[model samples]
Target: MHLIDLRTLQQFVRVAESESISRAAQALHISASPLSRTILNLEARIGFALFDRVGRSLRLNNAGRELLVNARALLRDNERLMLDLQRRAGGTGGTVVLGHMPGALYNGIIPDTARRVQAAHPSIRFQFESALESEQLEELRRGRFDLAVQTQDVSDPALASRVFASERYVLLMPRDHPLATTAEISLNALVEAEWVVTPERAGPSLRSAFTAACRRQGFEPRVACVAGDIVSALALVAHGFGLCVAQESLVRFSGEQILVRALPLLEMQTVYRIVWRVDGLTPAATRFLEALAAPSKAATPRGQRKR
Candidate 1:
């Protein structure tokens, strides 16, 4: 029987991503000769040339593209299987995979609920991933993530969501900022300020909302920088980089250097929801969901600041 080794598949995928065997080898900390030999062996076993040599570059053929997709799926399955086996061997309760939107941790509700579940079920394993709402939704649909937490509404009928927590939005800026002196900053007043926002991968929902709010104030927002997450965006604001809209719970980080101001005209409420598929859930996920159903207190999760 012919079989593909996980290691070989790994190298193949790495090469496919890097588009160069040498670069893949360097990234994997291995020699190029062996890596090239492994790819050739894989091509032979698969009865097709996976790569076409274009001068010095290795370009994926149609077969290679298809194989890469299946390879990734197989690797994900292998990882999940290995983790399940490890959990069983360790006498653990079970494993729960959770994904949440960027800056969901800033409000502390998701992590707090997670902590409660972990405390009650010490034997169970909890896997957490922080990503954009779109990424979380895609992963949830793919069965990669068991649950997701985000402020945006999930439009899919297959997924079910309920309000988990709510917080008002506040403008965050440097204490020395001209607008910091105001008791409450108006949306129109912020038209001229450079804004820092989360990266595009964070989804367009919030950005669109901010834009609409600005437009309603008769001016387009001037974005200065795009950060990886709301936390990072707020950090940039704290360092006098630009301004960001933060949740009311984030006020604890002001520290006399950053200022928090409410916007009455653009009063925005952040509504967080715990989303999961309508299909069956593992006992561990069910328990976690049950715990998460309650009105989450603003308790900070472990390793998170009280924001």
Candidate 2:
């Protein structure tokens, strides 16, 4: 009965995620033979086989699946402990990695917050990565990101989030389109109109919610293109590929070719949140979070912006 080291647990998690010793070794910059031996040793130490051999591939068995969850939590705790120790030893500078939805960048909230934090604490560095909602959540849990700005609230007990801004959904279309000049538009009125939408993925997606809203109004949206993010969707709309539903703040990036109309009938709002793990913030990350929560004199209220 011996305790497994963090390095061994990390190797186990990587093997479980990639499902192949060779692939995990490639990723870990090691050779397959040694990685395989490491996994065998870990299983021997735990007194259980963690994976099921199926042909050339391996799948996590029930015990492996349970261990995977605990392993991730333990790794996250270890990371936080190291960061805390560094801070106590008078480490004043560190990078705060932020994973965010594209809207946060397009609307300038994340950039503004970063500037404010850096101005006061010049030693702190910031890295911003834009990803889908589901990707951001996964990365956060894996300890890859210190913070995230998402469109929807997260319910995971491991993370904490608060709404910092809110914006309504608006219809984006080419300025020369038929509906561009219309004083009012309804979801039913766009029954024949084609749309540009985000691709459907796990977690709460704008596409799924928008599609359901369209169905409640007696029509399914005719998707003309599937864009990865709102910026791409706005570009598609600007080129007359199709109309799109996006956050109102995103209209700032639409240029002159695109017109934005209020989607009052749809009654959708994108709530921007500052999300972080409960005990996972490094010293720099904690400072950035505090700066984000403080009211800024140079910033405009996102929810009160005129449509």
Candidate 3:
């Protein structure tokens, strides 16, 4: 059977509402003859009569009532879909799904930049997913995320990235720990200290880099606890579990419970970057990227020593 057009469906609904073909046509500003033919064509396409003829008017049958309900719902959904598409095309609205490391939230760039974007385009929205660097990169490659914020250098030709900010790694310790009094500690000095670190499976970049840095200093880091992310690692440090090396931006989360110290000796810095598929950014995503590139008064945490 041929599909019934939307115009026919509309006319059918108006006729069903007025219970008179002549009255519905008058309301629609069309002649009664064409309206009657449109309704007849709809019934023929669907292989059923929609109305029962009374002496001078029509009453909707059960099939007509069901069609009216479903048609109205479909039309509403279609209208919403069109509006959303138009907004996106005009760069005024849409949702951007972001995959990021926990540090992104602490760094101030993601939250800071997002706030600015929303201030300009209130209709644009964001969805955030925090995971390990490796997991975030994998999800980004699979197209589950529109953009990602991470530290690892992405060399894949299919992806493009930009460095938005950089932060050095800092040592976090219990406020009363012996080394906490030191202004800057050397990596060699902490050879005997127990460390809280992220395991390779959770995120290999930080772990492998820290391990290499430790090896260069002539000793391997003695792991006391393994946490899934930097936030958890810092929590372990606060409870005297062990020392943790993390991005300086995370000092804000340490509150007054822990002491943060600079590791000038280690010279480790993680560069934060925004990455996306070379070809897949939506207009909304592009607008967000532009906001990130624009300079703003909100500053990302940098070289923070103690909190």
Ten-residue region with minimum lDDT total, candidate 1: 298-307
User: Tens digit of lDDT per residue, candidate 3, span 1-307?
Assistant: 4876677777887998999988998999999999888888788878899899997699989998899998888778878888998989988789989998656777677887888888999888999998777787788888889899878788889999999887788778898888877766766569989999987854546788788888877888999989977778878888889888887777877867788777766678888889999988888889889999999765567435434
Better of 1 and 2 by TM-score: 2
TM-score of 2: 0.66
Best by TM-score: 3
Root-mean-square deviation (CA) per prediction: 15.5, 16.3, 2.9
TM-score of 3: 0.86
Better of 1 and 3 by TM-score: 3
- The lDDT, on a scale of 0 to 1, for candidate 3 is 0.83
Location of the lowest summed lDDT over 10 successive residues in candidate 2: 298-307
Q: What would the TM-scores of all predictions be?
A: 0.63, 0.66, 0.86
Q: lDDT at 28 for candidate 1?
A: 99
Number of the predicted model whose lDDT against the real structure is largest: 3
What lDDT, from 0 to 1, does candidate 2 have?
Answer: 0.82
After superposing candidate 3 on the true structure, give the runs of residues whose Cα lies further than 4 Å from its correct spot.
Answer: 1-3, 26-29, 44-48, 52-56, 61-63, 131-138, 183-188, 202-204, 302-307
